[model samples]
Target: MWWGHPLVAVLTVWTRSAWGFSNGRVGVACGDMGPQHGPRPRPDPPPYSLSVDKPSFSPGEPVTVSLQALNGSFFRGFLIEARDSEDLQSPAVGVFSLSAPQQSQLLQCRSAVSHRTGSRKTHIQAVWRSDRNPPHSVQFLVTVVQDYQVYWVRITGPLVVLRGATESPSTAPPASPSSPAVLSAPFSSEGCGLTKSCLREPEGCRPDSDHRCVFLSFTADASGRSVMFELSGPAEGYVSFALSLDKWMGNDDVFLCVKDGGGVSIRAGYVSGRTQPELHPQESLWGGAWRLENGLIQCRFHRNSVLPPSFSFNHSLFVFLACGGAHGGSVLKHQEQPVVSGRQTVISGPPEDLRGSRPPLLIRLHGVLMLTAWMWTASCGVLAARHCKHLWSSRSRPGHTLWFQLHRTLMVLALVLTAVGFTLPFLYRRGWISCQRRDCDHEAQAGCRTGFLLAGSMQDSYSERDTHLTGPHIYGLPARQHTHLELPLKFQDTTLPDEMLVKIQITFLVKLLENSSFVMPPLLCVCPVSFSSVRVCVGLRSDGDVTHTHRLHSE
Candidate 1:
């Protein structure tokens, strides 16, 4: 009985390890394309075939590669790599990106890409690019995992000789245009919580057959080995979804379905903070397909129920959907706030309907506080100070006039509201977010208007922060342009007899430096130095030398 108990414990430990592999964390098998299924791969011929688009390519050129089940059946998992054709034992020479990033992921070394989940797939297409200094002849080597013990290892794939060299014997056929890479029809939402989990814009809008419906759904398979996801939305450049621990954007697993001309590019990425995502190889998805009909972009894909080890161990995550434009593969920020799930959810858990909202509560309050302060309180404070001084002429409170008290209270309240509103977004996002000159958020717009109030109230303090740049970036001054303004000192002019030559070239980095109306008039009075009096300050720890361009002119 004691021996039996020990054997059962050993079996339990083995089962747990195998369970993790079943979810497709197979970096351990990267050296040799083999599964740790406790059985040698069968010697029987595989029912699969590998295909490529062209026969040969130049160095660092992209080639389309496909793995197909010849018998028209589904394969559970697969690993494909590019290797030296002459030496099969060498490491993978090129890299691969998947057409679908849902059920697959790039390996640790990025030399190959494999299934991230055990979801069944029929055909797979990947873009493999050779390195700048690739092997003279490269061949793709594939290992298809049909079952725990029924997989085929080291299946020889197509070979490509170097460009300008003689062509080798062709092993794979050309890619077919009539492949299963395109969706046959539009998605339908006939079954919601009864069959799968659904999240749709406009509450109950159906995505089935309607191009206008913005919808997202996820369903775990009956065996719980994998989950399939569908996302349909209207976006000109890109539509994306993310799995996050909370409603915030940082530290999340994001997937993008970017519109690349005629077709779509599905990619996997990770968000470090509120910045552009770090995209993974195209080989990170499974059974991926996209449809661009009318203006809506629809995509379908699959992934494992168990998240990858590199991803967090937390299975419960909040879903986020966002849309944005990408310029030449660099994705921009979402046009607006993302639609987030109300509660945390485990994708593999029981099916349930989920609802979400676009803006956070903090954001709404921030907007209200900013609008009230700027449009109402601030305006009233200025009116009381400038116009109502005579109306409340009597010193009602013994020392302070009623208008003075009112103006002070209103101004103080406006400043407090502005500061609190500005701080709210920082609290919500937990950090600063980068934005373009034109694409700033509401918080930024409000902060810009209110920032001047605080800076003007506080006396200018000589504070210096660290600077990394040592170029023309510090002052955005033109290299050759030297237009100057005049400040009067004692008249000792060299050219003009009665005029004093004090070339006032104010350099204000933080302020919006427009010499005309939009510029802050108060900042100009902080320190007016004659360009001739401006000595070069080059501290050892400072960014660099501050050049006095108007040194050429003198009195």
Candidate 2:
């Protein structure tokens, strides 16, 4: 049974008396529909199986169908019919007869599937009938995938669709107008490409008259759940694709690969939370499949693994493409993140539509304030150290000590500046920290210990002074053996606020059996000058005898 259109093909299997003609019908076997004049004889079943090379076929691609018929002696004549899944009428049909009934034979046919404007799934059915058996049919389904497509976005230019580049090439040459491009080193954040809407390029992608470019063409196999990327650039180097989960540098999840002209490829992955993306040393990530042919590097990876496990197809992803040109012949020069000298492109896919959005306003303000306060504190401290000497000078330098008046003024000015600078951060968060130290060991046998005051709270906790620092560590005492200094301190108040009222007491224990004179180092104190005032007191005791007392203040 032949259809008038050349595109229609039907396979028909018939016997001498049984002419099976089944068309445009459903759930009806071909043998039952044969021209029936009277009751016919039933034949033995044919020993054969029908199979196709591949389960699916794209439009215009040919499918190879084979039927292996064994013990041909059981059948003196036979016929087979192949029909389209949608329109069963007018199928391309073929028939054959066994001259010598003792041999086995194979039946094969090749046909092309017509291209449809839209993607569709359909099947082709093959039915066989013989002298000894009823009509037997088998069906196979195939999906006709549409051709590949590409959208190009130039750095410093508008996003444009390159219509002619849909034909995927095996390899890329140095220059091709139709090639999808990466477009220069140190790729800026200004431009990228996607399969969907084409958005305008940002200001950062504006070209500065000198830029290099790269091109990429890709196709997806939906049945296999994989995508193939074909890359061509100036270098015979390597290529990589990165999925930035947060659209930020130093945090991209990337897949890197290298392929030689011989079609051998090696790959690596920088996944999980790897800040510095590098190929995994122990595992090869090219489990899917890849090749380099005709100067074009082709790579395929599973769609499910393109992003981190934390992200799904529904979540937006920042996609990046990069190429490492060959330096000479032995070593490949690849670009690091922020690709200074290399070219790159950033494309966004799914969910969020925009790339490279600015940070929130409050975050910017907090950074500026903290930086300014730190700078002010450092400058004031340096100036005070260079000019003020009254704070550290002793009575031995009587003549030079006359400069105390000028020194005190500079010292006070520095304190006021430092206090203001140091208080800004605390003011922003209403928190500050203070420390007090005491050495209670009278014979200098115990090691040094430290304490702390928790910021922004009245409660305090102290750790046991277990660590030893007694290796003759005489920090502010006269240089002599068997001579020691003991200091004890207590804090009466613990609250810290804009105006913290702090009450502190100190005791000094000095043992001087060989030396008569004792000296006390100047104590430094600072408080938030914006609230009120600050004061410091020092008492000197020698050989178990009270000697001198001094009080310092600045309001």
Candidate 3:
């Protein structure tokens, strides 16, 4: 064993060197038989080396420091820690473990620690130990850079109303000094007492004083847009108001007003409505104009209408005014002044001044509806006429009685509906009456006269009404003077012109044939005749000696 020991030592040393651990310690010994106790090989000391990269971070920003261990024998784990200048020996700011395959660790600094001049620093170190060796450590410094920016928010328009006796917690009062009552005078002055005291009462007129009083209060957002408002009456009554930011106002600016029967009272600006009476008492009115000035919106309401009042007997004066304006911002102030009685009340606000017109699509749709109704009525009349004949011919067949009854019923219905439909256009055109006065009497009397004439003409002159014809001429002579005439059948006088006389003869023939079904001819086979042509020929003959001969042909 002693003889080969030196060779074993040499081989072990070669193996250690090949593995890059040649400097590490190894033991050796020699036997007496071989050169007895030769010098023992000295233990090679463990190698140790460390490398660190520069730290990178912004002020108030998080940073990570890393240290690399190299040329170390019997390698162990590493330690990482950091601290700011505020403490000389603070607890390790952070600690991390090191592992194989490029071992590394991370440490985080508290966000509160800002990077000031020499105020922030990060320290990193790696700890490792070899077998039977004292622990060794490597460290690196981390410099922190200061980087920061300032931020803030700005608000435009009036500040929010914090508190006041009369002021609304949510909105600011309108800055306008004039009351709406004064602005809408004359028309508004006629019915109610103009005296200052009377105007203050809920009824709009104080019995003892002349001043009228109305109060309105509401909230608004940062943009001076109306949030909401409440109106109180002298009696047990009140009202609320709101509007949206987007609405169309035409040439006449929209305004809200409280008026007596004669249109005398206080008023507010233009508002929106979801339903009748310009006030959507059921839904909260939102996103409408409250006031207009200098082309800017002073206030904007919520996007919905108010809910209906819970109690039926409760009286509320809520009203809405929609005016015209496109791209108006929000409501900023009430242009009208307040009326004061016992308490300050908003009488009226700035009138909603809108800028644009309505779309053309709505007008076109209305016209289409009117035309469709007219065409439908005419078609119904023609269809009834055609179907009535079939039912009349089949009346004798079994089960045909129902069809005949239905046909008769439908014919009457169609006739009545067609008459109403035909009259509508004439009425709209104001052709049903010739009267020009706007008074109720004139209108009623004209309507009565039109109704009477229509009823009489329908009953007594059915043939003339249906055929568009006229009456007879003198001594059965065909007078060629009259061109277009429509007359009732009750007149037996034969002094009418030739065209009128021919129409009467044809009407008489038609009635005679209809009354005597037994002797009736096939009138449908007669075909349509052009009376205009026949009249032209007759008129030519009446002209002085024209001598134009015309042949009459029948098919």
Question: Per-residue lDDT of 118-188 in model 2, one digit per residue for the tens?
Answer: 22212222322212211122132211111121101000101111222233221112232212233223212
Q: Rate the local accuracy (lDDT) of all candidates.
A: 0.67, 0.31, 0.27
Model 2: runs farther than 4 Å from truth? 1-209, 212-239, 247-253, 257-270, 273-314, 319-375, 388-555
Candidate 2 weakest ten by summed lDDT: 150-159
lDDT (Cα, tens digit) per residue for candidate 3, span 1-555: 777999999998875444221121111100000111112111121132223332222222322333322243222222223322222123323233333223233323321111112211232243221122111211222211111111000101121111222322322233232222222111122222222111222433322223232333333333323333323222211122322222222111122323223222223332222211222221223323332222211222331111111111111222222222111222222222222122222223222211122223333344454445335633444454445444554544444444344444444454465456445545443364343232124333333433443344343222211321123431233536432222222211222343354353444434322321111111211112222222112111222222212222221
On a 0 to 1 TM-score scale, where does candidate 1 land against the true structure? Answer: 0.50
Q: After superposition, how far is residue 49 of candidate 1 from its true place, in Å?
A: 26
Report the CA-based lDDT of candidate 2 relative to the real structure.
Answer: 0.31
Report each candidate's C-alpha RMSD, comma-separated, in the order given: 19.2, 25.2, 34.3
lDDT per residue, candidate 1, 1-555, as tens digits? Answer: 669999999999897665336666677877677776755564445799998999888988889989899877778888888887655556788888778888777887566888877768888888899888887788788888887757777777888788886554322123232222789888888788889888877678877655556788888877565677888888878888888877777778887888877887777777867777776544335678889888788888765443232242126889888887878866777777888888988787788788988989999999999899978987787677668767986776457778777876786788789889878887887776656536755445435433643555343321111112233432343223332222222212233312221232223322212211011212222222233322222111123223322233353
Model 1: ten consecutive residues of lowest lDDT: 512-521
Better of 1 and 2 by lDDT: 1
Q: Which candidate should be chosen as best, given lDDT against the real structure? A: 1
